[model samples]
Target chain A: MVDHVGLLSAFGLIDAGYRQAVQVMEEGGLDGSTSDPDFLVATGSEELRADIPVLRHDGKLNPNGRHMAQQPIELILLKQWASYLALPVWLIDDSGNLLYYNEPAEALLGVRFEEAGEINADQLAEHFHTTRLDGKPYPNAELPIVVALVGRVPSHDTVRVRGLDGVWRILAITAFPVEGQGGRHLGAVAMFWETHDS
Target chain B: MKVTLWGTRGSLASGGPDTVQYGGDTAAVELRGPAGEFVVLDAGSGIRPIGEQTPSGTKRVDILLTHLHMDHIQGLGFFSPLFDPEIEVHVWGPGSTTLGLRERLTRYLSPPLFPVMLRDLPDVTLHEIRPPASFALGSLTVRAELITHPGPTMGYRIESPECVLAYLPDHEPALGVAEFPDVPDWTSGFELAHGVDVLIHDAQYTDDEYKSRVGWGHSTFDHALAFAALASVKQLVTFHHDPGHSDEMLDRAMAEMSESHDLEFELVPGRVGLTTCVD
Candidate 1:
């Protein structure tokens, strides 16, 4: 099993630039400020006016840039840890669209990353509605990722998902809803696990 | 109101010396309502004897099944009343995914499984219980709650003018505990069984056995005791003894269960031919 704590630590490293920007805003007397980017642009506050963009080398962010501020180093380390963990994770919107998925998710769902790219959470929910396997209709209320995005916290339970191989596999899907400032719904993070394998 | 144990064996029926004392019949319970109205719990093997004893007449036998576990419905094939042209039997149970109650029962009672088909049986009506609901038979009121089990099993509460008896002979408390977090607060089953006169519950496993078979659709004697205490029931009869337990083992279990709970309720190990009056 991949160490979850180590994986989280790696996430912190990979998103270091984003993390530092947030920290700067928090410490630069911008705490509790709800000014939009347009408003900030117009105001031209001296602190906010100082824009810093990390330079990139090829596809990766350059670690040794004057404006990089140690964030890129942390980001690279976090990405390395996350990739090593091989976690089955995905990002979905409130309307149940698949926004992003990791490599492990592809293996768990038994679909090619390219093929799964064409499908989304809404399509999956629709498929569940019309499909009948093992002589039982798929329970709509029991769908984990959908329930999470729709803000319905289901009790901890396992749901059966049919794989491409025509074998039914139980999956433990946990949804964590993401909320922004003023509790504005951002999206949701979903984690899937094979029941027996877990 | 007389409640008779037509069948008391849990799981499968055992006919040898080991089960002779408690009676080897599986899951059938007959409740005689006011004016001698018959309310059969399950049609397990015990129903064979009940069918033999119930006089052949144009009387309607009301059969209420908790679920369609083989041991619970196996005796339907041998229920002699179905063959009697004068008798009209009403079978009520939960519906399966694809079939209604009658259809599901017929699947088991028909050709390949049985020599006699259900459609060919004389004067039988089947009702499928879909949601949690109630019904009235004469003056008695029957209420059912969908319980947590592998299949769609239900716990029934029968109320009359004089007494209230709650029968939940096949339930696993942990399943309920998992669904409703406030289960320990005595909310769900207690609300239905509150102040009942007699609470006959599923006590299939001891506390030790429950640890291994947590979600296997059976409850321990401790869980039953706690429920009876929460419901403030007058008497608690532990039904559905694990097939492995002998008469002597059950006696020891009852004794161990009574030591921890300080209540003025009678704790009895249910036996065949045992009769109790509700009123």
Candidate 2:
């Protein structure tokens, strides 16, 4: 009989409990030769590893790692492009918690995320509202992360909250939903462009 | 050489007990240079006293005016020199908006405003001025610039070998478009008056009064300071005092004028017969 569960374990797909199943499959093999099922399972694991890349310390893919890792060339290019364009880019989860922010975002907003483990978007908006020169409420509907989480795609040139050193600044915001592995919706990535008024 | 004011009133001359102390005559000043050469700035109601002071003779007179404002031109008919045929008075002023200089003077000197026409005046010639121009008479070089006033008015920068004096009697600092971009820093008149010995500027209102009377073609003392400081003048004589101001009020205003930055210029309120040597 073909032991599908044991084949998946040898390919590093199953959990630790599947180790006995893999031993039983090896004993059943008459000449201890690799079968078509085992070969198919190994090939599937290689393909899966190739499709999802692991991030390195420098935010690029580690090519020399033992695990099959795909290069995050597109993500690295996006970060570089965002910085070059002078746009603030940030990733936020469904609960409106900031997950990641690019260099431009730190420069424009004047917020350092080096020591920050978690950031609440609503709290940040509230703080911006109180400190802004115009002294107006920041509407949630106008926030890019808010719109993206609610499954509503915002139009281009939408203004977002931006205040720096007692001066009011205008920002254009856009958001896109990010889908991770297993078709899971990770959250949204928001891009901001600050416009200065002379 | 000496320059003495006989009248400094503007608009309609208001003569009353309150105005009598300052001699409520309309704009007139007598400038006497060396070799007996003399000129008058304006002929307002103040010309009566100036006429009384003129020695009885056939001496020629020169009269220069900024405009035909009633207070500026009214004294022409009353001046004693125009009555003498041998006096040879030469009257100069800014050209009229719709009429020539002669015609404009004629309209005022004719029947409606006065009994005599300008043409009938004996030996008096009216010359229209092309301002932002300069002319020389004896030892004095009189330069006129287009100043901001109700009609076209000219601010004069009279230079003698001894000293330079700038006279902007009816200036409105906020009038017209300020050619330069910055407010409180740039002034067209200040550029024309840089480094003068004395600046006689219009101080027609206090800061409080100026708020209600803005665009009335006059300036306050604060506006005067901005220009005077920029010009680096030695002495700033505040003139064109508002008719409503009292002697006590003027004293207070003069006291507060020193609160400005150390520009090393003396601030003095203008009064009739207040004489100072130009040099």
**lDDT tens readout by residue for model 1, B179-204:** 33232222335434666788888888
Which stretches of model 2 miss by more than 4 angstroms?
A: A1-198, B176-186, B259-263, B277-279
Evaluated with TM-score, which candidate comes out highest?
Answer: 1
For candidate 2, what is the DockQ-based docking class? incorrect
- Please provide, for model 2 over B163-266, each residue's C-alpha lDDT reduced to its tens digit, 9 standing for 90 to 100: 77788888876543333111221244553466778787888888898878866878887778777876678888777777777666777777787765555788
The regions of model 1 sitting more than 4 angstroms off are A1-198, B56-58, B176-188
Quote the chain B TM-score of every prediction: 0.93, 0.91
User: In terms of lDDT, which candidate is strongest?
Assistant: 1
TM values, all candidates: 0.59, 0.56
Return the lDDT, model 2, position A182. 18
| Residue A148 of model 1, lDDT score | 48
Question: Per-candidate DockQ versus the true complex?
Answer: 0.01, 0.01
Error of 1 at B257 (Å): 1.6
Chain A only: list TM-scores of all candidates: 0.48, 0.48
